[model samples]
Target: RAIAGIMVTIPEYFAGKNVLITGATGFMGKVLLEKLLRSCPDVKAVYVLVRQKSGHAPSARIADMVNCKLFDRLREEHPNFPDKIVPMSSDLTQPELDVSREDQQTLVDCINIVFHCAATIRFNEPLKDAMQLNVLATQKIMALAHRMKHLEVFIHVSTAYANCDRSVIEEVVYPPPVDYKKLIDALEWMDDKLVNLITPKLIGDRPNTYTYTKALAEYLVQQECGSLNVAIIRPSIVGASWKEPFPGWIDNFNGPSGIFIAAGKGILRTMRASNDAVADLVPVDVVINATLAAAWYSGSQRYTRPKSLLVYNCTTGGINPFHWGEVGMNVSLV
Candidate 1:
């Protein structure tokens, strides 16, 4: 979007900036990683923190991710695109995130932006596990961000359902039901059985531990962000791409695609759901775009604004024009 030959500020801001991303292997994480590399071509480098998965090392996982069909468009544009990604070994569940001393020092010295995208997305995740990944890991990341000397902005990819207990969702970070400090302490001493036994009562009105812990994580971010330029992007029901890299681009069978696929194939018959409910499904690319733009703005010109927490609810709100045909076809048949 060059007006008189000047590059657009959003892409321009990302130029020459080193980025550190957590959860670079998840569904939305893959899209975010790809989009950052493709869109911000001149960006210095992308450091992705990855834990070993399914007997694959962090480096191997990163290679598999870049080689996936999702990066076909990106690979065509830049044949050596994979060279820009540097996978750092780190596990979110471990103490201090398992980030080694040298790597931690390197990140502190060179990282310009931090995107904490990792989280346990399971709807039925145990309270202890969810709090560990979503809340405790976030707390550790915030501490790490505080140490980054060149950090310009920190963007946390949160779910729109973080505040699902509310009837009307707002962009503001709502007050969490429990104090994260107390919860963390309790989880340390409390047995898994006890936590599971109290899960229903702990989550209260929320459907699962996912949302409850996410809400706690958001609150922790809000409290810990301090003077850092930070933005929390809460995307709802992120589905396939609308039209960035490609249309109908989805990697996983989780989320709405699973239900839609089953119904489309006449496998899922008469699933219980209200037609009147708002299915707030957002595209993965859209969320990535918003996240990029938000970082640019948060880092560039928004410094003068009263450090008010910036939260973006990136969702269709059940009223988008792009969704009717797709939903009508997939869901109506069921």
Candidate 2:
């Protein structure tokens, strides 16, 4: 049933499977890629959908990603690990993900699994940009997934804060604040100034544009479940690695990583929080593992399971709960 506590058949599920991954260069995405390469060694190929960033090509970026310290163990164990990671130049914000005709055809013909992780995570991002990257891009990816000749599973990565307005979170898609289609159509012709004026009201009780659009994106993704195998993984405040490639492996200052860094630097003097409020800090590796598990389940259990989108609320609050008072104390000690 399990090998070293991991499901024995999970690795077998990915064997010789062609995986198409978006956001391959992001925090969680990189860890997901590494685990797949290191654990699922027999995987046919990992097609990373990337774009030209900071004047560097996708291939160059991927080469640098594989050389990072996170993949040190993997590189040492399997020197040819990079061979399976194939980078395909594409932009999520563009039509058809800005993938070339040749690459598009290749994806449609061979890609068996899809991981849509690319999105604008900035909390202060403009509504239009967030909608474009989060909502519209998701729609485009779903359309593309439908065309995949051998597609078995489509895993979408969303944030746990997507429905933060609600106190009790569950593994389900909640109603959006507004109709996604109507909002998209209304914002089509609105100028930047007018949209900005109404942005706060549009987002309503939600904290930021990021969560708002992400919720809408989830709704849109669910609409495509009838046509393809779909699963959504909502991770809460993803922190550094737990025990996969290495311990304390973190690259970005996005969530708790930033707070930890600031505390270490002695820059974070004081913080305010309800002492008893639950701090849901799920590690990046745990999220990736859950993602892979979801993929395997979607593929192998489709026939036995009901015909509906699977939503995995990958959080640790209910199981191993930690409070902010304890977190602050730990950080202070550190």
Candidate 3:
């Protein structure tokens, strides 16, 4: 069903519910946070897991996040929007997510929903680092979610290219290239140089460590969803905002956003891509909407669909398909 159909009363579903979000500083995470705050004004609280980056503390970072232009509408409407957002100092790369005991207990007691969006998106990231952040971190989060007494839904954000080894991608958890457990055990004692040397062979036909680890992470998440109301959202080549807060409200130079910017500035003169290849560019707002709706649907249908993981292929190609040739033409015009 469409997100609009599933979530007829979006605010009613979210009202008085506490949401815990990871990667609240990232592009999609920020938009998710904004939508929850702006649309679900009655939401009890939003707890964000953040680590100190650069010289800024987690609280300082979240303060800066709300102050960004993305939250302008929320700020104008509800000047106290920031009050509902509580930042918990936590590191995804660490064991148990480095969430303090007090914060962990608080989350266990109060958090009603979780959005696990924190992941290293760098395509060229080292295998060990990617596994640590993407795979192990997810495992830790799942463990935490299992302990959450009041948890209603657990939404994990994965990429559409996770199973890109296959052309026809489906909304299901496919078998990973390698057994994640064995791979993690092997990498434990292996030298970094040796791992780097064999990285290409290890990844096989997959493009990068990012997708490879994400696939492993999905497998792990599926395995751990013993009794949890789990849902996975796989968004393809997320681009600038198409609606909601504003159009073209993009900050980072990752994915298509970077390409569009480089093309506009004449930095990306030409690109090599098959004309017939699908350009599955999904808007950030649409992805967030689907994510929120998935959370709501999971909770509402808990009895009807007990413990079954719902995988949403939040892509545009299957519905409104576009080709890379059109993208090139548009970039050229830019």
Candidate 4:
């Protein structure tokens, strides 16, 4: 049933659609890029917003990106698949995201959908840096999306733990402890170390600045209201795929999953998390598929309730209910 639905929906609906995916170099982003290309072969173009890193040009980055093993299937199908990939150079931290006027105009004229996945994923990122990348970057993206004349949908890939302070998290935007604008202002003026030192006090109950700022980002999206067709996909800790392409094929050993790997290798000693605590992990492919579906659904079903933003909590907690101990055991075995 799932395979039939994907076949019926993807190419027929997504073909020739101009998509702009940020953070195309990241793990989840790579998976998304591969899936789209392999599944929707005729996709008009994929405009990936990438920053020039280590003196490498945008074109060079694109060249390196397509050559990755993730795009092996696409490479085999269409060796010239690189042509359909338009790499746009833009820095997230800059005002207007540093996108050139000409490039911005090009995006406005052509882009139909946007996947905003770029962000500082580090749990220990400085508060100021976190605000700049996670919060301010999102604001800048929203501004750019507003100018996209042909934009149909804007999907924000937010974390499900953004509302972790609450016991039973809901599909809704929870207010942050600090005012978004005030926090931005404070971080702008204060020293990085000072901000980092006070972060714990500032973000009460919240584990780190990452989740706190992400929650603020959701609020900013809500501020968009009637202006844009938006969907907030709050996915739990993304794990190895259950289907599509392959299973248990993970790359970077980051997040809690990294801890599991370390524990399995006998590298990690003591653990902090409770053994029986629910490990809310949703597969990367599932999240990508759900995001694609949500983007389509959100576009067709416009929200009439302006006060409430569309939040879909994608997690196994409500369904599978796997625990941390189970995850540890699985990692050890696999």
Error of 4 at 105 (Å): 0.8
Per-residue alpha-carbon lDDT of candidate 1 for residues 67-156, written as tens digits (9 for 90 to 100): 888899999998888888999899988887898999999999999999999999999888988988999999999999999998989999
- Return the TM-score for candidate 2, rounded to 2 decimals: 0.95
Tell me the tens digit of each residue's lDDT in model 2 across 79-150.
898999999999888888899999999999999999999999999999999999999999999998899999
Output the lDDT of residue 185, model 3.
96
Q: How accurate is candidate 4 locally (lDDT)?
A: 0.81
Count of clashing pairs, candidate 3: 0
Backbone clash tally for model 1?
0
| Residue 213 accuracy (lDDT) in model 3 | 94
TM-score of each: 0.94, 0.95, 0.95, 0.91
Candidate 2, RMSD to the unseen true structure: 2.7
User: What are the clashing pairs of model 4?
Assistant: none
Assess the local accuracy of residue 23 in candidate 2 as a C-alpha lDDT between 0 and 100.
Answer: 94
Candidate models: Cα lDDT each: 0.87, 0.90, 0.90, 0.81
Off by over 4 Å in 3: 1-8, 332-334
